[model samples]
Structures are given as structure tokens and as C-alpha cells.
Target: MPQSPTAHDPNDIQEFNLDAVAGILQDEKLDYRIDEHDGEKVIRTGFINAAISFILLDGSLTMEAMWRGAPSTDAAAQVLAATNEWNLTQFAPTIRFFELNEGTLAINALRHVVVSAGMSHNQVGSYVMSSIESAVQCFEWLEQQFPDLVTWKDEHHDH
Candidate 1:
């Protein structure tokens, strides 16, 4: 006599491991944490960029940038909207943000945006390579012309 597909003996020891499979799935979704520090709150650095701690002070809102090559302006705008909404819904009230393309003009705009946002020069990248270095050099010149604001986190050595 052979056992039926839906039939199982109640006393049989089931030998499949379920927990190990779930653990592997969770690990794959985890983001890389680069740095963290505590002050009035906690600041963290992750795979893409740095994150400032959320504070209750007036004009104290958290923001971040995701800089990489994108297909088109429409795609970039879509990503920005999706990211902004996700951040607002999952965490803080609002976040100031933008997406920079891999082109020369977009790179220049990003430099200006970062300086205006009061982020450190080290945090920004030109993303120029090969023959594009000359164009990137021009953008750097433009960035030098614009003065950067001294942000609070750097002043207190919290970064």
C-alpha cells in the first residue's frame, strides 16, 4: 500500500527547516550602515548618503540625496516623488530633496544644491570620468564661486 498525497501520519517528524529560509530573506533586505553618532539625537550614514537626526527645533527637518545614473528626467522625477512620499509617510513630516542626473548640467546643479543645502564638500561627488573630466572641472569652478552656509551639525561636530 502507498500513502496518498494529502495523507500524513500525525506522529511523523516533519524534517523541513522554515526559520532558516526566513532569516536569509530578512538579511538580503538590510541596508548597509556606514556610521552613527549620538548628540541631541542620532545621526547615521548609510550606503547612499548621510542622515541627520530628527529634532523638534523650528526649521529642523531631515533630508537626503540619492545620486546615481538615471534613464531620463521623467524617471528621475518619478523616483523623487516616490522617495519623498515614502519618507514622509514612514518617518518625518517633510523632507527637502532633489535628484541629479549623470549629465554635466545636472552635475553642476547638484553641486549648487548641496552647497545651498549646507552639506559638506566631501559628501558631494562630481561623478565625472574619462573625457567628461573637463566639463566636471568647469562645474567645480562654478561651485567655488558660490559660498556655502555653515550648517549646525558640522559646527557642533555631530557629523
Candidate 2:
């Protein structure tokens, strides 16, 4: 049987690792910073934080999507559109932060919302993947526009 949405508490969402994500942001040459609050750590770069805020706001706008119970295609499209908008907004803040700091760590503390947003896409089938693709495209565009601002290296896991 399908579990009802009411059974889930959005606030009881899981936490994501800032370190892993931070490494990715760093590889992309996005200035990221970390901070702690109430035993939780946040990993954000100025650009990432801004982008996340925008995406969260936009995704909230589509909250009705959950209630609509529409076709998967329609749902996917809506998710993609909102995700793209969020990615764009996120990009601006990150870029501005990069310009201000010149590729220094600028991310704020990690928040439950960021984890929730990622979970929402991950559990919702292609919605999250589509959103991720959108974000990747934006990142690529940013890289192309500012080649010096982005960099990457082989994964060197220090045990």
C-alpha cells in the first residue's frame, strides 16, 4: 500500500554531509565556507547558498504539485522548470560571492532545507535528477564563462 504523505514530517528530514558536498564545490572552484549551528554543520559557498535559497523558494511555489497528483510527465516538467529557476538563482549568488572573494570559501552553515531539497528530488523519481542536470548545466555555463574560476583534480581520498 502507498503510504500517505501526511505520514511524513518534512521537518524530520535527514542531514547531508557538508564535507563531501564542499569538496565538490571546491573542485568546481566555488568559494565555499562552513559554519556550525546547534550541533549541525552547514556547507555553503556564497553562490551555492544563494542558489539554494532561490531553488527552495521556487520549489515552495510548486508545493501544490504534491497535491495535484498529476501525470508523471507533467510533474516531471514542473519539477524541471522550478529546478532550473532555482539553479539560476543559486548561480548568481555564487558568482557574486566568487567575485567578492576571488574563489575563497564563502558557504554558510548547512541547513535542513538543503538536505530536504535534495531528498525531495532523489525520492521523487526523475524530478531530482532533472533538477541536478539543470544545476550541472548552469555550473558548466559558469565554468565556460569564467574558466579561471573553476578547477578540478583527481579524487584523492585521505583515509
Residues 1-159 of candidate 1: C-alpha lDDT, one tens digit per residue: 997688544333333222222232234453323233333332222222122121112222222322222224444554455445544553322233343434311221111121223222122212111112332333233234322311122243345
My TM-score estimates for the predictions, one after another, are: 0.22, 0.28
Task: Enumerate residue pairs that collide in model 1.
Answer: none
**Alpha-carbon lDDT, every model:** 0.28, 0.35
Tens-place lDDT per residue, model 2, 1-159, is 997677545434334333434545555575656655455554433332123311233223110011101123323444344435544666321221111233332211111123434442123323322333444454455445435434453253233
User: Model 2: runs farther than 4 Å from truth?
Assistant: 1-123, 154-159
- Point to the candidate with the largest TM-score: 2
lDDT of candidate model 1 versus the reference: 0.28
**What's the lDDT for candidate 2?**
0.35
Q: Specify the highest-lDDT model's number.
A: 2
